[model samples]
Target: MFKLRGRLEKHGEIFEIGQSVKSPILAVLPSLATKFYSNVPTPYEIVDAQEDRKTYQGTIDNVNRQVSEGKQGRIFAVVHVAGKQFKITEGDVFVIEGYWPPDAGDRISLDKVLLVGASDFTLIGRPLVQKGLVRVEATVIEKTLSHTKTHFRKKRRKQYMRINFYRIPQTMLRVNRIEIVGEVNHPPDVTGLETRIF
Candidate 1:
């Protein structure tokens, strides 16, 4: 009778304890997880894409009367592509988004240049792409070594060696000319003054 009483008491105590103990996961855990994910920003949002288009409108300085000289050579321009900064070298090959050439792989000359600006002067043309100022054409010059990987195994131990190299294809460009189809407002008239100072 005593054993039976003890067993009954122990069973009752276990039931009470079980009811008092809380679950491993609290009710609020799910909410906290949801909140954490909701607050994080996606990788695509790191750079604001809308702002890149606005950069098109800006002052262009045509240094050394680059517009009038008609001397054709490689020119450097800072352009943004897909939320990234790109230095466009003259005679480089690049295709426009909407415009397509008859030859798929053939070099398409940029006839409608938007603006021409150098260190000295800036010439703004119509919305049309400048015929003479578009990117020049160059073929892939050479492909250099890009990367290398090596692995060695000795005495049950593994060793890894990795080398990385990046190469960009270069093109040869012969500048024909640069011409602005539209007009320039408040045209800069100063010519013979000190080219060094404003």
Candidate 2:
């Protein structure tokens, strides 16, 4: 007699009495085997710390050389603007929804950079990149209202109906340029309001 176990109890298997054999259920369902016997460690090769550091330093030096030579090529950046994040490149035009303070023709620098990329490499920031490292300049080209939207409500039996129309303000921005202004991994000094007196 063969005693089925767990979920396989419904799907019975035939075997000779007192015969010892591996579970056919595990053989049929490899995934279940992994769930039940998942303690096996995956194999990975280890590298020397000095060698790894040398490789990392070489990559940084290559990026720095490219930046210094002005050959990093067309750059792109993910910048935070008006509580929204936009992936922008030079000469790109994008819209910002809702009220913004910058007037048309006003030039501004987007400081909260989440990432910067070029043809060769990419730099990802933890919330934000180092200050003055990547500069993203843009111009407010126009400000206008979005298309009108209608909101309607109705109630059956009571015979109540309401209608409303609205439009949201939008700001248009044109990215002027994106460049690496400071060395990689180097941050500028933070001087907090030294010229102001309380």
Candidate 3:
């Protein structure tokens, strides 16, 4: 019907009225539904998931390749996790605020690498580096609540007072390692630059 056509157009879709396809409302609706989904935009979760899927079968494979070539050592990277950015190194233990889903003892890989580095080189991601290029592994060590904070308010001579306390859930993570599976630029060789001795 004409009403259906207008609604589809509002959603930025267009349809042509076929001359020979004389079908009832029931049969045409199914086909229209299919077309609607195809034209509509997908949720960001689906989009990021499809793009972030790791293609590398094994991080060890790339590590072996790096070892064979003797390219670099002591890799570090900035990764995004739990709605926050963290600069992490191997064997680092850090706490992330808020409740995270993964249970303790669960190992997880974070691929939202903003930048990866080594003693010799750096690879900067436009927003996020390509999937399977840099892998950051971590283990959920503990999940616990933070120390309760007290909020107290009082007005002199008014006899008004209020008090509240709260503890935020937090997750503890240990950075297992960061592996670079692709080529990167080497950092400048300035031993004095590290300590600002210039």
Candidate 4:
């Protein structure tokens, strides 16, 4: 059996794009950035990485840190969506409102992964996704909820009140390794898709 991309719901439904969607679908939300840069530096390398294991580990750690700083993430972010603060889990989809900063706006892809354990092997982004991989796409389902109220007061007369509400909805995405391209800079083409990730 295939493992779930994120979390499963009590009565949720899974819809895979190709073949048949056998997995469950939940609300999909993008991650937020803790900090940002006006110009995110391109992927780079650290010198003398293989001089020592400790040094190599340190270099890896530093690279990961840089990636985190450049990309948007849920870590250390105090999101106040819809007048409420919430921490997003790995599989959660949060609909954030308000003006998205230009640098922070747009589809910010995340590769600073915490942990990715597939059923077969636990490979890092060295070999991103395998060929014939599954592609997942989710739409903004809705916005978070908000409340509105009206009240009337009068001397000796009874008071009247009314209220309205709204909530943010979201679509969930669960994509698999449709095609493992073996490199991040060069993603392979997914079958049926017009273009591949560049």
Q: Which of the numbered candidates is closest to the native, going by highest TM-score?
A: 2
Candidate 2: tens digits of C-alpha lDDT, residues 145-167: 99999999999988899999999
Model 4: lowest-lDDT 10 consecutive positions? 26-35
Query: Which ranges of candidate 4 are over 4 A from the true structure?
Result: 1-50, 53-90, 99-138, 149-198
Estimated TM-score per prediction?
Answer: 0.26, 0.81, 0.56, 0.21
lDDT score for residue 155 of model 2: 96
TM-score ranking from best to worst?
2, 3, 1, 4
Q: Model-by-model lDDT, in order?
A: 0.38, 0.85, 0.72, 0.35
All candidates in order of lDDT, best leading: 2, 3, 1, 4
**lDDT tens readout by residue for model 1, 1-198:** 011111112312322222322322222132443554576776665555666544433423333234446542444554433233334555454432322223333333433344555455554445533333345333333323323434544453456555554443332223333333333343345634534775
Candidate 4 residue-wise lDDT, 81-103, digit = tens: 33444433344565545433323
TM-score of 1: 0.26
Worst 10-residue stretch by lDDT in candidate 2?
Answer: 1-10
| Model 1: residues with Cα > 4 Å off, grouped in runs | 1-66, 69-74, 80-84, 90-116, 122-133, 149-198
Q: Candidate 3's residue-wise lDDT over 85-184, tens digit each?
A: 9999999988989878899999998878998877755667889765566779999999999999899999999999999999999899999988765443
- Candidate 2 at 138: error in angstroms? 0.7
| Candidates 1 and 4, the one with greater TM-score | 1
**Candidate 2 ranges beyond 4 A from true positions:** 1-40, 189-198
**Candidate 2, residue 67: lDDT:** 99
